[model samples]
Target: MLLKRLIVCLDVRSKRVTKGIKFKGNVDVGDPVEMAERYCNDGADEIVFYDITASAEKRPIDIEMVAAAARRVFVPFTVGGGLRNVVDMRHALLAGADKVSLNSLAVEQPDILHAGALAFGRQCIVLGMDARRVGKSLHFPSGYEVVTHGGRCPTGLDAVEWGRRAEALGAGEICLNAIDTDGMRTGYELEITRKIADAVGIPVIASGGAGTVEHIADAFSTATADAALIASMVHSGEYTCSGIKKELAEKYHLPVRLTSN
Candidate 1:
C-alpha cells in the first residue's frame, strides 16, 4: 500500500507566510523559510508554498523567497502563483521547487501545462485547482466551478472536468483546494474531492479545512485522496505533522512514515 502523505502549505504574501478564513482577511503567520524548515524537521512529507497575492497583483512569484525556503527543506517543495508561461515554470524549478503548480495562468493559457510538462517532465508539473461550490448547473454538472486569482475570479469551468482535462494534458498531480472550506477547519470538501479523484489518474492532494487528525484520516479513507494539505491546523501551533501521521498510522491503520519524536 502506498503511504499517505501529509503536506504543509504556506500561503505567502509580502514574503511572509499568512493564513485567512475563506481566502479573506489574511494575516501574517510566520516566515516561509522558517516554517518550511520546521515542518520538514517535524516529518512533513512535503511542503507547498503559494504566492497568494502574485496572481491578484499581476506579477511574478517571489523567486528569492522560493529559493530561500527550498534551501531549508529536504522534502519535495511545490510552488505556485503568478506563473505566466513555461519560462516562469522553468525559473521556479531552477529556484529549487521540485514541482511547479499552475492555477490562473493555466486557465489563461492551457498550452503552458503541456509545454511545462514537456520542458520539465510531467512529475514536475502540478495543476492547482481552486474550486468553489456553485450548486448544480448545466454548465457545471459537478456543482463545483473553478475559481482563480486567489479565489476572486470564477472561470465557469467545471472542477471535475478540468481535472480530467489537465491529467490528459500531462499534469502528473492535482491539488484540489476548496475555496468555500479554506480556513474554515470543519473538514475537507470530500464530495468534490472524491469526484475529482475518481475522474483523474494522477495523484490528488486535498486542500483546505483540515481541523483534526480525524479530518485528515477521513480525507484519505472517504475521499480516497493520496495526500492532504494542512495550513491553519498546523499554522496555529495546534498540531504537528509527526503527531498527525502517528494518529493516522495507529488509529486509522493508514500507512505513514513514522519518525521518532
Candidate 2:
C-alpha cells in the first residue's frame, strides 16, 4: 500500500509565512523560503505554499516570492491562491511548483480545471475545496455545502458533488479543507473528509483541525484520506512532521518515513 503522507502547509501572506486560528487573526511566523527549507530539513513529505491572501487581495501569485520558497525545498511543493487562468498556472509551474491547487478561481469558473488539466497533466492539478458545517437544516438534498472566497462566500454546492466534478474535470487530487476546523487543532472532521474521499477516485488530502497524533491516525484510518495537511501544529513548533509520523507508525503500524525532522 502507498504510505499516507504528512504535508506541511505554509500559509503565506505578503511573502511571509503565517498561521491563523479558525482562519482568522493571522500571525506572522517567518520567511516563506526559510520555513520551507526548515520543514524539508525536518523531513516533511511535501510542502504546500498557500498565498492565503492572493484571492482576497485580488492579485496574481508573487512569482518571485514563490520562486524563493520553491528554491529552498528539495521535496515536492504545491502552490495555490491567486491563480486565475492557464497563464497563472504556467507561471506557478515555471516557478518550481510541482503541482498547482485551485480554490476561488475553480469555484468561479470550473472550466479552468479542465483547461489546466489538458495543458498540464491531471496529476499536476489539485482542487482545494473549503467546506463548512451547515446546520442539518441547511443541508440540501445534495450533500454538505461548501464555502469559497476564504469561506466568506457560500457556494451552496454540495461538497461531495463538487469533489466528483473536480475529478471528472481531470484534477488528480482533492484538498478538502474544513473551514470549521481550520486552526482549531481539535481534530479532523472525519465525516466530511470521508464524504469527499468516497465521492472522488483521486487522492484526497484532509486539511484543518489536527492537534494530536491520534487525530492524524484517525483521519487516515476512519476517513481514508491519502494524506493529512497540517499547519499550526507544525508552524508553532509543537511537533515536526517526523514526530507525527513516528506516532502513526507506532500506534497503527502505518508506513511512515523514519527520517529525521
Best by TM-score: 1
lDDT of each: 0.92, 0.87
Model 2 clash tally?
1
Residue 109 alpha-carbon offset, candidate 1, angstroms: 1.1
lDDT of 2 by residue, 135-170 (tens): 544544434678887688999888888889989988
lDDT against true structure, model 2? 0.87
Off by over 4 Å in 1: none
Cα TM-score of candidate 1 = 0.97
Q: Residue 110, candidate 2: how far off, in angstroms?
A: 0.5
User: Which regions of candidate 2 are displaced past 4 Å?
Assistant: 136-139
In candidate 1, what are the lDDT values of residues 73-192, reduced to their tens digit? Answer: 889999998788888888889999999998877888888889988999999999999999999899999999999876889998999999999998889999999998989999999999
Name every residue pair that clashes in candidate 1.
none
Best by lDDT: 1
Residue range with the least summed lDDT across 10 consecutive positions in model 1: 65-74
Clashes of 1: 0
